[model samples]
Target: MTQPSRRSSQADPAPSPAKLARVRTVAQDAMRGARWWTLLDLERILRADTEFWRDLWAPSLAIAAHKVGLRNARSRLDEAIDAGFHQTDLFEPELSAAFGADPDWQRVIERARANVPVPALRLTAWPEPGPAAPLRLDRAEAHRVPQLLPRLPRPGEGAWETAKTLLGWTAGLWRHANARINAGDALDVLEQVANGARYSCVEYSIVLAQGLNALRVPARRVWLRRGDYHDGIGQGHAVAEAWIDDLDQWVLLDGQHGAYWADEHGKPLSLPELQARGHPARPVHVGARELMKDPALWAAYFAHASVSGIAWEPKGFVPVFQDGQVLATERLVRDSADAYPRLSDLAIGVTAIGGAPAVELKPVHPYAVAGSWNGETITVQGRQRFARVLDREPGEHRAALAAVTPYGPLASRELRWTAS
Candidate 1:
């Protein structure tokens, strides 16, 4: 294979007057729709916050015309992330917290410097469902993914908040179902839920993914193995990861604990990447964070990690997200194959020759679909691969794709189409 010559992320060319107007429009709409647009604490933070420029950032003022998004409207405030302003923790403003003896909350900046960084994926399309391929919406019996977004019980902005909202909304519902029995279709499980039946990790994962789909965010269930007999978390662990368009990366989220994984650098990570970081105290230090106000759920994450399972997906066979939820927490994949196969690098990557997208997915499954879009409109949809169009679409054609296994939709990846 030839070596990739292009940089992961490059300096963005100056936007034309028209494009600049579009940026202004995007910034405007974001402000109009933002939930954290105004708050008593935010007013104080922005006024006193020198984090960004002289401006309050734009979150409440404009994202603080900087954080990522608005989450939980009340005493329940998750850090509202202002995307463009502080794309990474590296750009975080000054922290007044006492250092050393006191927690240097500001250390987030130093840690970011020590971590290996990847280029933010470029996007040409709007971050929504049309750009990303549709999951098993047909399986929902009565409601499709879009149809349920308004009703999914989560209107929060942070990826972390959205995940827990789904889990809590379904509290006391999922009992247990055999993995293989319905390993492929999460929509069906969703369909059955109306009848007041129980669900498993698969159902939870499916709903989580579909809910993301409803919000127009690219998402999929990520599967992990608890290999090495860690804690016997069964065969593996499964969780949903959502692609945050502004950040240009996928954020791993678990509905059960309302948790997410983060590197020492403060960048959100996918489950595969998260599991890859566990080294028993090596060069890399990985950790998980919870959405709850209380820190109780944090320790549970490590205990949950002790379960026995594969660190990654097994060779030749791609595990579905449904079974992962149970295995990741319980430490065992239900009815897992007796022999543990070697781990495969199933990380998704794209291969572009000219200025076009060539998306390739690993552990290929039959029911899954991959697609690309020019903005929000569909440009091409593929059953197997990108045997479709030119990543050469005019302007920006964002890269997005998805697949629904017999069990449910696997995780989806969203990236910018840099080829054009």
Candidate 2:
């Protein structure tokens, strides 16, 4: 496939001297006594034209900031003043002076200060949720495969058997439970497996690797910070890619979810479908130390626990922000497993609770809830408030609710009336 055009790196004209002075001040404060420049701090100082900063100065600044050893340094706004970097407007005079003296840097700063492009507003209808398949991969099969996880195959042996094994495991689970096999059900099973276990994406990947190994499949963990389509933020995601003999190319699999790889319509997805969206794809290999230093990666990876099938690429890989400072440099991972659980599990539960009775519900997290039921409807609040009743009996009521204003439905539960 043809690569997308790279964003332009041409610098715009410098901002007014006064504005430049202000920017310099912020940069000085950000850089004073600090070892390096943080993408977040730079972003805050140059928030006016993020696109220009991202496209033109961001790359250079990212390198420079890291070189300066400011990635983990605390903000030095106060120290900038002590160091004569800050001016009357609490701006960095040194940075201003640097810009005035260095034509090249001046040009970059100018471009970085340019106006941002207003995104075009377009209205697209949200697609309807697809049907939920039963939990595939029975407990016994799940236990068996993990124990029998095959060794990493030889380079030329291919990953088809591994893929088939995963598929068979999931199919067995679904069939045993008499449940339909769909994307959502697959996620539920994975979530149960995770069970609040705190493991790095790599760790999770390792677990999956073990399972795949037991099944004699060659698999590797892929990781990266993915950009969001709706919001221009970067978060981490994980996926397993296995070599497939049939396709003769490595196919991406949601190891966190079940084996059946389907889109919203339940149609199977190819490798391309499982890749990242928007940005050029890069392989992710993170060590334990790096993962610990970057906790946002974990949060980012898990944020999409409720999304549908995978998108081809990340929306973008902007710097991660925390308390107005760029805490982490983010890149969009093409294959993310983190989004699977959130999107698939809660979505299916909400669908099951559709139109159920209202009850006295108390939500634990914005994503989960518990409540007492009444004779009519079951009421619950989580990501959103929901009520439903089964068709067979009035006492059989269910509700799904979200604590916070969610993009869609949240927690779901069903309860039947008991003799009082």
Give me the candidate number with maximum lDDT: 1
Give the Cα error of residue 335 in candidate 1, in Å. Answer: 27
Instruction: Give the per-residue lDDT of model 2 (tens digit) for 1-420.
Output: 222232222433556668766765666564554423343344543534433343333433443433444432212322222222212222234345423444465544444344333322211211122232221111124445543323222222334544645533432222122222232222334454445423333333334544554443434444433335234443444555553434433454544333424445544443345342332222222221112234333334433321222322344433433224342312234444422222112221223344542233333222222232322333444443433332343233232323221112233333333211
lDDT of 1: 0.40
lDDT of 1 by residue, 1-420 (tens): 122232111223455567545544554464455533332223433333333323223323322222323232211111323222333333233121112222543453344343433333454532232211212221232345455655567555644444445545543345445443265344555557667667556566666676665554556665544333233445444556665544434565655444555566766665445544543211111213223443332323322232122222234323233333333332333222221211111234455534445554442332333332322322234443433344454455545454332223334545455432
The C-alpha stretches of model 2 lying farther than 4 A from their native spots are 1-161, 167-204, 213-216, 224-226, 229-234, 260-271, 274-420
Report backbone clashes per prediction: 62, 67
lDDT by candidate, in order shown? 0.40, 0.36
Positional deviation of residue 243's Cα in model 2 after best superposition, in angstroms: 1.3
Q: Alpha-carbon error at 174 in model 2, in Å? A: 16
Q: By TM-score, how accurate is candidate 1?
A: 0.33
